[model samples]
Target: MQIPVINRSRHALPEYQTAHAAGLDVRANLAAPVTLGPLQRALIPTGLFLEIPVGYEMQVRPRSGLAYKHGIGLVNSPGTIDADYRGELQVLLVNLSDQAFVVQDGERIAQLVVARHEVVAWQPVEALSETGRGAGGYGSTGSA
Candidate 1:
């Protein structure tokens, strides 16, 4: 699936790192480094704009290494970018660790996954059908 994109930053275009990777790595487009103190959050710009197709959306997710090592992650995990949006792609990152984290220009800060979705129509049913574990949630099932 081809999507139209505009890149205003000096960094290279986002791409998948491996053969079967589901997400493409996205970089930060900062002129200088941005430091995030512990528990602090910032909206990092990508300088990228896209025209996603109808019925499709882009998901912005955190990099595992950054999240595990530096406690750097997206404030809204798996953030959804609607197909109609035509603005610059910005990532909301937060430093969850005790120490500060610095985001540099061209650094792979997040990942983007393009996905297709379906719009559901409400049936307005009076009640839902029963299941083997009806109404069971959050540890209701055994760990096994």
Candidate 2:
């Protein structure tokens, strides 16, 4: 699919991949750098402002290699960017490891997947349809 991407600065739109075999990484621009502390907290910045189309959203997710290597991850896994929002994308990162981490400019912080969704309007009802494991939540099923 041809997604319309805009670059306000001279920096290029985030490429999905390089010549490397791994998936492409999203990066911060030259202006911002995200810092992760031993406390496992980071303030991630959205390199560019986006205008996503309606019915679709951009999901911000962690890179597996980074997660495995550095123990750094997005605080809100699969963070959601609504279509109606035209703002900077900020990622809250948590460093699961014992050391500090730094996100450099043009470094891939996470992957963004543009996805389509259906919004449902809620209506109050007295009862809901039953399911196989009705109301059984929070590890109701055995963890093998």
Q: Give all candidates' CA lDDT scores.
A: 0.96, 0.75
| TM-score of each prediction | 0.96, 0.81
Backbone clash pairs for candidate 2 read 16-24
Model 1: per-residue Cα lDDT over 1-144, one tens digit each: 999999999989899999999999999999999999999999999999999999999999999999999999999999999999999999999999999999999999999999999999978988999997788889977754
What's the distance in Å from true for residue 46, model 2? 4.0
Which structure among the candidates has the greatest TM-score? Answer: 1
Across 46-138, the per-residue lDDT of candidate 2 in tens digits comes to: 556777888988888898888999998888898888887777777777888888888877677788888889999999999999987788889
How much does each candidate deviate from the true structure in C-alpha RMSD?
Answer: 1.3, 3.2
